[model samples]
Every structure is written in C-alpha cells, then in structure tokens.
Target: MDTDAYTTMRFERRGQILTVFFRDPAEANTSDLAIHEEVGRLFHDLREEREARAIVLTGSGPAFFTGLKDPVGSLLWQREQGLPVIDAGRQVARRIVWDLLDVEIPLVAALNGDATGLGATIALFCDAIFMADTATVADPHVRIGVVAGDGGAAIWPMVMGPALAKRYLLTGDPVTASEAAHLGLVTHVCPVGEVLPAATAFARRLAAGAPLAVRYTKMAVNRLLKDTMAGAIEQGLAHELLTFTSEDMVEALTAARDGRTPAFHGR
Candidate 1:
C-alpha cells in the first residue's frame, strides 16, 4: 500500500500474509490517530483479499507499542479538528481493537519488544503470538486511569486463570515474554530479534494446512471462548467509555504528562 499517506503505520505484504505495522519509533510505536486508521484499513484489505491467509502484525521501528495515544495530544487534536474527545478515542479503539479482532484469518503478533495497554491488547487479538525473549507485555490500563477497551478484557482470563488475571489486570503490571509464553498468553519466546521470523514460520505452517480444516478448527475454538467471555468485552469497553469524560481521566493524563502521581477524587 501507499505508506506516504500515513504517519503512524505501514501496510506491507509478504507472500500470502498481510503485515500491519505500527510506527512511531521515537515513542515506542505508540498508538495514535494515523496508526488506528491504518490498522482498520489493513484489516479491511485482508478481508477483501481472497488469497490472503494470515496477518502478521508488528511494530515498524521498535518496542512493539507503548500504549494508547497520548490523551493530551489527542485532546488537542479533538479541538484542532473540531471533534469530540470521547468520540475520537472511541473511534480509535473501535478500529485498533474491536475491528482488528473481527479478522477471521489467522492473526499473529510479532512482538518486536514490549507492549503495553492498547499495544498489548492489539497483540491479544491475534490467534497466535511470538515475542522476543527479552521483551515484556503488560495491560497497565488501570494505572493509566481507564479500563481496557480492547480484547484483553475478554481473553486475559482465558489465557491465565481468573485469579492471576485479576492480579495483572487490576494492577497494570508488566509481565515478561518468557513468563507470558509459560502462562499460555504467547505461543513462543524467540531470540531477541527473531519474533517476526518465528511468527512467519508458524503462520506459514498454518497456511500449509488444509484451509477448511484450519479455519473450522479456529472457528470452533474461538466460539468456545466467545461463550465463556460472555459480556467481558462489552462491559470493559463500557467502563472505558464512561471513564473518558471523567475528571479522573483528566487527572491521569496530567500525571502522565507532568511526571507525577495522580490522586483521583473519583470524579
């Protein structure tokens, strides 16, 4: 695709797989308006391409993704573009998380490095993930003063037990890639720079399998989780939506920008 138009992501094709990459090396591939739009467009392309059998999602420069777009920067964009802050964030989430998860083809996360908040959630949408052994992953949404609106809310407990899930989800703690592989959150922990190649190997294996059998198997498995997750996705996303307009969200962003602690008064 023509990457000239996007400032935050790039779309590339490798054999039968579609690669959607997050850009923003200076900020650890942080989420932003441009990345969100490109993610949606990439998925749409994958859905439209009959020959594409899988997706390899990765970060362009490094560090997977830091997290959500800067709320302060986003608010500025909201005013500059004459848009509502709530609507803009929601739109970004819908494209990056909700829309991305709806992809039917096998999805793979190539963790170039650490992933956090929306970054980690993006990886969670994938059917499989391969991470650099040295990389780490974390939810950290709660620490940022918002609930996770991405697939993490629904699938986290399924990967790890509900007990551990609550611990990590509530605390916004970081977990290493090796630990994640051991806990079933990721499939493999590759050498520091082998994440993309490993993911490609796995996807190529799936691509080599009988298409019908693979698709049916994936559908059955995901359907089972869909039943188990139940209302997790909706409830978590609702929590995030309600938080955006709150004084706490403002306080949280200020704390992030100012390099200080936040004391939310439940407003």
Candidate 2:
C-alpha cells in the first residue's frame, strides 16, 4: 500500500491497472478533508497515465468505504473558517465519481467488505462492482442523522428500483449480498476470498479489449447515468448543504455523539 500525507487513501499501479484503496481502519474507512483531496488527485493522476487501462478501488481494513460522518460539522467547519461551505466533501466526492464515470479507462469496485454512505457511493460510481459474499452495502445517511445525499440520492434509484431505493435510502438500512445481486446492484458477487481476484480478472479482460471501443462504449453508458442523475444529485446536494446550519442537524449530531436516537423537530 502506497501512503501519502495528502491522501489518506492508497494507490498501487500494476501493469495497466491502478488500484486505489480507502485505508482508514477506525470509523470504518471514513474520509476526512485530506482524504477527499487525495482521491481527487489520485483520479487526476490516473487520468494522465497512458498505460492505465483500468482502475479498481476497495478498502484496506473492513470496508470499501464507510461514507462521510460529520455532514453538518464538516460543512460548518468551512464556514467557521470563513470559506464557502457548499458541500465541500460532497462536491469533491461527486467530482471523484464523475471522474470514474467520465474517464476513458474502465472502473471497477472490489467490495471486499461493508460499504456505507460515501463508501457506497464510490462503489456505485464504478462501471462495474464486484462484491464479496460477506460484504454489505448501505447508505445509512438518514438513520445516522442526515440527509441521504452524497451519491446515494443520485445513483441508488438508477441501479435498484424506486421502491427498494426508497426503503434503503430512507431507512438507512443495508442490502445483503444476495439481495444486492438479485436487484442488480452489483455486477458480480463472489465468495469472500474471490472478490479481489474476480475483479482483477474481470478488469484484465477489459484491459485487453479494444481500448478505444471499450472506452467509447463505457462513455456512452455513463452519459446515460449522467443525464438521469445530474439533476437529482444537484438538488439533494443543495439540501444537504443547507442542513449544515439547520437545527435538526445540530440535534442529530448531538444525539449521535451522546449515543442516543435523535428526535428531529424538522427545523
């Protein structure tokens, strides 16, 4: 695992493939400001590598990603610093996903374990995602005391049906591996030990395919997601930014820190 001060994430390049891993062990592979910037940089670098035909992302410890934790405080901290607080993490994350969506290279997610919040979004943005049978995927934003923003609001409904999306996103519940595959949320669901190898093998196939044809084809499908999801992402991200200053978020954070359930007054 390659480490950097700027990136809490790690990067490893093997022949024509680049693998990025979310390495935060505590808080379940959570991301902070530095981590966000590093992800952006990593994508930028990946784009510049002429030999890089594919990219695979996963987590180091127990998750593919766990999502952003301090939705309100993260936004509020920027305000306190007298900087514009407009979904900094969300915006960065959106750009990261967009890079995966728009890049000419193939993108894959090897979901070795649990992925939640932003983590779920990262996995969803990939052109293909491989999940281990032991892993779980969730967007626990609402239950954890926040709006289901990030990429969940934008991407979940597009993959899964509206009814199932509504239940999971709103309730902040998880989808099991079998259920995820049945719903077409993941491209491949393998035994716990096979996820990485399966993902790499799949990516290698794409790596050997006609590069221009594959890239263009991937771009075409991504545009479908962009056209369908851009609006929802815009609207949801806006609302999430507003929640930073809203009283409900404050109460929610307080309750979370105190280890209790929040009673949102809907301020």
Worst 10 residues of 1 by lDDT: 75-84
lDDT of 2 at 168: 91
Tens-digit per-residue lDDT, 102-168, candidate 1: 5567888999888877778778767898899888899877775777766677778878888988889
Superposed by TM-score, candidate 1 places the C-alpha of residue 28 at a distance from the truth, in angstroms, of: 11
User: Which residue pairs in candidate 2 collide?
Assistant: 67-118
Q: Which stretches of candidate 1 lie over 4 Å from their true place?
A: 1-7, 25-31, 67-71, 75-84, 95-98
- Candidate 2 TM-score, C-alpha based: 0.88
Best TM-score among the predictions, by candidate number: 2
Model 2 lDDT-worst window of ten: 1-10
Model 2 spans > 4 angstroms off: 1-6, 25-31, 67-83
